[model samples]
Target: MTEPMTDLPCTARVPADVEAPDRILWGLTARQIAILAAAAAIAYLLWRAIGDRVPLAVTAAVLVPVAGAAAVLALGRRDGLPLDAWLLAAVRYRRRPRLAVPTEPVEPSGWGPVSERRPLPAVLRLPATAIDDDGSIAVPDTGSVALVVATTVNVDLRTGPEQAAIVGAYGRWLNSLTGPVQVVVSTQRVDLSSQATRIADAAHELPHPALADAALDYAAFLDELAEHRDPLGRTVTVACVAPAGARGEAVRRAEHTAASLTAVGCRSAVLDAATATAVVTAAVDPFAPTDASWPRTPPNDPVTAARSS
Candidate 1:
């Protein structure tokens, strides 16, 4: 016995003659085989039902097993796997390692007890841009002002020659003004639904049905009257007077600008009606005239005490 060769169980090797089976009956994954089987069954059932004129019961019998297998496969494939799980896994797999080292923890100084450091409140940390209501970019304070409002005008439609004269006057006024002006036009639809509802309400409150109907009819007539009467068309022209300073020169410049605007068909007046009235009154007061020749006082003192008297 050549030193009696005893093979250790752990060290024993598989025999070369022993081989794994080349064909496995259940080698296909649960999903793959089920899908293939389902497709074949569906094809067979369709052919039998349509081509062979089989009854629905027989067709269903063939299809039910295929459908069941397909459902089971689909359910198994989806089981416990959320839509974002794969995406999250991929992101984690591809993430780069951070390069920085964490700071070492240190004991607090003996000034006071160590307090927990909490992060700032989210509201306080929000950017100023996020605080704006209109979501517009912040503008620097440039010290500019603007006033906007609607305007009304009474048109004089007397004669063609009158219109021509007015036009000529307007042209002169434009020649006189020194600054730019803006004109705005807008239209709005009047809502009659509220009126209709009111009429209906009144009709309902009438003592008799006939009276109620009559009242509703009257309301309808009123609504029609409002709708048909002079469909309101609006045009707004602004005579913007921007004076650099509130001093006498600014006032004179403003007046000159206004006169020029008036010559062009544009009516220019000081925004403050009272101030314009006072100036005009002072200029025209005959009793308070400083000189007999001119119907005006010094531009600086338009409203002198004598003129006021």
Candidate 2:
């Protein structure tokens, strides 16, 4: 019923210049342009070394640049953080050398902290061993369920004492967890599409003429807000992972997590496959919303629907 009066939000609060990707030189990022220059220099050196050997020099010119680029990219991709990121990770690893050691019971497990210098996949490795109808991501490899999505707590508007109590409660829950649990917070554009749909839904259900008219006005305000800018939203995910093999164990953990969050003044629940997919999809590409991937809306009160579902 509150949908029609919803406010649109602006996400990606980084300044325009900071957010804008650097163009190294003439439409090239620093990484790309720098690499190209290095490759050219290496090719020139190879050609000079093979001078007077006509065919050999020409071959060296082509192969040297190709080999240099291929080697760097292969190294970067294999390490999971290409070029710049990999270099940064390498420095951090150097500062703490112990991270280079392989994890115990490793190889096929696909569990535990990612080692310092290993080739990591571009996408996070989900060790997803199975899928539950209720939408839990299961991993039989470690008898764990992964990627369990949960909502965030908004404590900024609360009084200091309330915020402190909520934080303490959440801390206790973390201390109580028996196994590995990963929580991820990503900065994503506000889901204005969903917000707008909700407002429309609430407006339709209103029978009071004055209220409906006011709802319509608010909806128009949202439309105008969207055209200009929307405020940023805070999205939080509490993923329960590395629990026991039993399916019930996963649910138990999730329930505990949800209850703890509720006590801390946050509305929380375990997500099914459909919602989980949307969250992951948005993480990868926030701009693309597929018809099949996004749920169709008829403007229902999300809070009521969440409770009923």
Candidate 3:
């Protein structure tokens, strides 16, 4: 090995203003400047509209709070949403009492910005034109893409040292891959009652009655738990997308991903056409039901019996 050279030429220098992360206005940051400027603009507009009829003192009194509130709502985030969003929530929250089997709203805000809540024509937001047979999403503007959605392995369940080891291994594994992969975690409200029912049913079909009874009791317990609990479920999915013309490449990449996941001691399933559609649907509307709910008639109901008969 060659000895370390003390005289290495330096080729790189830090760019100017790189340390200043955000825009500064006068002595304050941009957000502060925006708030002040917006409040002033609101006050000025209001003064021009009604200054002739109203006294200056009355105008100032009304304008101060209104302008301040507007500025804060527009510039600040509350509950991870702008304060203006709380206004639209009022309508949805009001309907809470009327819900039959209440499902949590997808968005915490359950609302839109107050200024944006004003009457305006609806806008088309979905860019996707179709979902291809190979689970590719087709967008007229952006073209086709095949995607993979996989489950997440829990790191918290492992011990501290194990977690560190896993992290190191995962880092290495990530380094091995050349393409882009996105990790997404969705917080959902899932209805697991049907799965529990199936589990209990399968258990009851076994030879031992005791085991069957125990399984049923456990399923009932789980059902109760779901009803009483927060209903929040976190699903982790890793996704990779390939272009429309490259379906084979997408599948190859997905297969490699599956093998990597298996090597890491994690279970993962790639989404099929239908499941991918549902996942996309849920992403767009998180409040969408995790499972289908079909109507069932009461055992003693006359109309149900009449139809069957």
TM-score list, all predictions: 0.24, 0.48, 0.48
Clashing pairs in 2: 3-199, 4-199, 9-230, 9-231, 10-230, 10-231, 10-232, 78-119, 135-273, 201-299
Per-residue C-alpha lDDT of model 2 across residues 1-309, encoded as one tens digit per residue: 566533323222224554445775677666666667776677667667665567875776677667777457533553444576677778887765343332333354556565665542232344454456555666657665534445566666766666667767877887799877767776555655556666777987888978988877887776677678854555677777655556667666777888887877777877666666566556656555332225322112132354554
TM-score of 1: 0.24
Question: Which predicted model would earn the best TM-score?
Answer: 3
**lDDT, residue 156, model 3:** 64
Which residue window of length 10 is worst by lDDT in model 3?
Answer: 292-301
| Residues 1-309, model 1: lDDT tens digits | 479544322221335633332332366544455566767777676766575677777777777777766555443433345223444565776673333223433545668765785332222221111101111112133111111223343335434454555556655655555554444344433334445556778788878999998988887875786678633334332433334332233234445545554544555453233333223343345234221111333224346464553
Q: What lDDT score goes with residue 9 in model 1? A: 26
**Lowest lDDT 10-mer window, candidate 1?**
126-135
Model 2 stretches with alpha carbons more than 4 Å out: 1-130, 139-164, 289-309
Candidate 3 global lDDT: 0.63
The CA root-mean-square deviation of candidate 3, after full C-alpha superposition on the true structure, stands at: 12.8
CA lDDT for candidate 1: 0.45
